[model samples]
Target chain A: MDIKLQKVTKIFQAKDKSETVAVNALDVVIPSGKLIGLLGPSGCGKSTTLYMIAGLLEPNEGRIFFGDEDVTDLPPEERGIGLVFQNYALYPHMTVRQNIMFPLENIKVPKQEALSRAQEMADLVGIGELMDRKPKQLSGGQQQRVAIARALVKQPRVLLLDEPLSNLDARLRLQTREEIKRIQRETGITTVFVTHDQEEAMSISDQIVLMDFGVKQQVGEPQFVYDKPINLFVAKFLGTPPINLFAGEIVKNKLLLADGKKYRTETQAPEHQEDLTEDAIRAMTHEVKVPICNVEIMDKKAPDGDVVIGIRPEGFVVDEKGPLELEIFMVETIGRDTSLVVKDPFDDNKSYRIIIDSSYRVKAGDKVKFSFKPDKMFVFDKTSGDVL
Target chain B: MLEKQSNVKAWLYLAPAMLLLSVFTFYPLFNAFFLAFLRDYEFLLGSARGFTFLGNFINVINKPDFGIAMKNTAVITFVSVPIAVIVALMISVALNSIKKFQGFLQTVFFLPYVTNAIAIGMAFAFIFHSDYGLLNTMLGWVGIDPINWINLRQAGNADTSWIRAMFALLVYTIWGGLAFKIMVFLSGLQSIDKQYYDAARIDATPKRRVFSKITVPLLSPMIAYITITSFIGAFKAYRTIIGMFGESLRPPGALSKDSLITIVGLVYDSLAHADATGAISEAAAASIILFLIILAFTLIQMQVSKRRVHF
Candidate 1:
């Protein structure tokens, strides 16, 4: 059940007479026997892509293939794809056993065989004793397990789940996500799961495809995508308390702040700026160097133009005699680490966040200075929003 | 003082409906039962009415027409209610699957329930006419001769020639009664959660199995409701049948020497033509019997409903 989606796109005509591109030119190949997650923010088309893969929704363009068979035109039933809806759409009238057996019966499986398979699925999902209970009689988690069993009983070639654990409470969601991963591994079935929660996706998926605003932002292993995000959106979307971005320019090998403070960087500066006119180079230099500070400069170069620097909270280290100073506005102490909200010296209206050890004492109104590891700094072209 | 006032205000809120129910519903039911047990008495003659328990009841059982009328009512109710419910269920399922013009189709099916029964009866009479009837004309096109449908009022109509007209009248009555049942069934269908169907499809349950296992069971409450209502409606099939068949005949052995009659028809006849004391008493007894028969059917239906209802 190798699921492949080629150049898939979906445009929805909203009730307000506007067209929303739900999935734009998306392509992904999910290998059989792996649990893959499509993760993104709300309205990012992750669920739309999953629905298209399940054959529940028709994409405006592109094709889907399961194994060697092109099933883009097939209906959900004909595609032999098992789908678990977000709300766990279990038949309310049927008992757990009946719900699990329903699909087998539909495919005209022998009654005795269907019953045995249903019982086996029910046991696998851990609802064996609750076989006689109707859906409404079961708890939310129990009902969800029944729904999963019902989907799996048919032995579909591929399984599609649309935010299956989203309806559960926090503790249950965590428990169910683990159980789903275990089941996927045990069955060795190709599964596509959709969720807006990055943690859930990272925890369960063998590979993750992160999406934003109908476009594929990045796709890789959980750690790979998290550590080396393809763009700012992916970087910000994957982390808790997103990465911090600053307005700065690169001059020679030093990154210059908007207030003209020069910070040394190991990153090589682009070579084309060496040919700029004297005035242009001077203007760039002035923007990088602070007028108030006769600060010690380890390196200097003619600044070229403006660039935005991004830094994750974890990237900054608080130290005495650090280059950047800040006034602490709020402190959040969470057992493992403490997050500090400090005012930005470069912009009066803005505040930047920094994470420090939980043992460090920091309160509102405390003044602190921070220096970031030069190698960890990310400079982006401000106008283009591309990494520089 | 505040709590006392709150209690008083609660009672005030409930007072109107309570008063209305006592006056309109409870009072009449007890009064009907009490009237059924009363012996011969005359208010105009200033004579005291005395209690005679089971006296009128026994008299009703003795009348030969009583058995026949009871059998006729049972036949009509049994034949019409289940058929109406089955037809309504089919129509409702069809309406549910129709994506386009669904509202229009629903309105068409529902129109009969709201339309005047007299009008429906008249229209059906024309369609079922022995000579220029639409049904007979269609049958003729298919190489079948005209059927005197209104004259075949028995199960063995081919042999029981005497019951042909009555049976036709029964069919006409059933047709006139179908609109309301269909509307009820449609509403019931709409109320079912669509998730069940989706789950069934995912499970690979065939369409027919889904309908039987999920749709039918979930729809039991609606089926029960329609069954009771249709049965009651069938029992009250006088206006439609009489309107179609014309109103001149009376029962075969009426004391007033009439030809065609029903229990209610006998009551009307007794009140209008025969002013005899015994005749009036007998009519009252027949009314009581009709009431009891409907009551017994309803009670049995409710017991069955309680067992089968899903929610």
Candidate 2:
């Protein structure tokens, strides 16, 4: 079922009577019959949003609808949602079969039918052989399956998982995440899972909702969100090696990069030098020079100011006659891609990385000239950090 | 070689405890077993006429007070242990589930445990007093005639006195022991993973079933522990009755060994008459019997716990 949250807000009162807004006023529409991932770092309110949807937490200021039915005042038991906790939360005293059958027993489903349905769910989760084993006797992956079977046996409309794969070993985490995806497809339930692992969300979710400080940053298909980020935070958050940022600016109508001492300028305009307060020059450090025509600014009208440039590690292209030049200090192989750890010509303190084809004969101590792919680079306003 | 040296070091660390136990616990216990078999033993003279096969045991067993003590101990252990345990479990679970004033309520319930049991028992005596006490005055308010709870001999016949005194003793015993059991069960309840309850809530499990199927089973280990220890504690029910009925340990005006004389009380009585022939030996015999009874009960509890407790 599609779930809708409108202007939902949650506040927690601390022991000293101070109030902290855990989930600020937010609106989101989760489409039906697809797996959506809520992705964020710790304390980002993703889990809080999930609990509010499950009715375990009451939104301090708004309404929730499961499809067209308002369920804001309903208790968790009334909402047709199956929630799996991070620890798997299986009843340790019960065997796998009993754990899977507990929900049915509560709803007063017939004993024989409950038994068959539990067995079917266990089989669906590839744990049919572990029915009689207690949760403690099984491995974490097996216990997770039992918890899922227990959740699905009652046939809830929505399945919510909170970092379900976090407790598993790396190899098991990969295997079980795939297993979860397969089960979601087989059941076709509208699922929402919370995770801080960007790769996990990108690999499995049909749509990813990225959040920060209890506010939604962006929401779209994972690949779309990755290729076209809305801000610097989204760009930096979604990549593994992280997007490289440089203190650069736009001059006239072309892009100028901070390449070295040759480009260092008295950035504060002489006319504005008397007003160079800390707030005005807050993160502005200018070493901009060498305009090139190949790069494109996101918003033409917003160009011509000290700005930041975000370049994906793969955006660099080696050319003998390009504008950007850097001295490579190290070259390391990452499967088919080679990482060139080059010294940032503009800032000696930063270790700049450029990923290139491993087949290229790039070595340490090579001075390389590079050009940018306009689409792979982003220009963000220096003060507000928004894409320009 | 290093392991051997560590073993010696471990023994050195244990030496003081061993010496203390030998003086205060082990030696007395051994002497009790030694005295129980000797016939015609005298405490003051430190002499025995001769050793006889189960002579002291036969003498203690043949006493009129012995059978009464055994019956009284059985009644207190069986009646009070289950009531105390179940009541304590309910109180602890209720205490745990409330959000507000939980710490204050826990401190209130735990007050009796820290207070001396004898002091609490004396307080209970006043509460259950027949006249000019809080209980009888409350009964007067309820329009029910005040029942002579402690001094039962002033109110009824032999069987009636026995019944009334037993009722009073059971109440005092259950109340006196509840604080410790409740404290234990409360900590046990707190240690349970809250995720289990959340999962239960999501599953639409009714609160009653959640208590029976989840809370109770998860708490079985603590229940078993409390049951075993409480069984041992109830079997040693002496001071609670003394505090309620005073040092005489029976209803006022009742004949000797008639009502509320526990096994420990009977043992103390036998030990008091040390000038009499075979008195200390009989005391040793009575204690040995109480020890065997507690041992048998604890062994049975462990066996049951092995099969039932989840942990």
**Model number with the top DockQ:** 2
Candidate 1 C-alpha error for residue B40, in Å: 1.6
lDDT of 2: 0.87
Per-candidate TM-score, chain A: 0.84, 0.90
Candidate 1 regions exceeding 4 Å error are A13-18, A249-254, A257-308, A343-351, A374-377, B1-7, B43-49, B150-171, B246-275, B278-284
Per-residue CA lDDT of model 1 for A14-86, tens digit only, reads 7799998999999888888899999999999988898787776899999999988999998777888788888
The candidate that achieves the highest TM-score relative to the unseen native structure: 2
Task: Give the 10-residue window scoring lowest on summed lDDT in candidate 1 chain B.
Answer: B250-259
Give the top-scoring candidate (lDDT).
2
Instruction: Give the worst 10-residue stretch by lDDT in candidate 1 chain A.
Output: A289-298
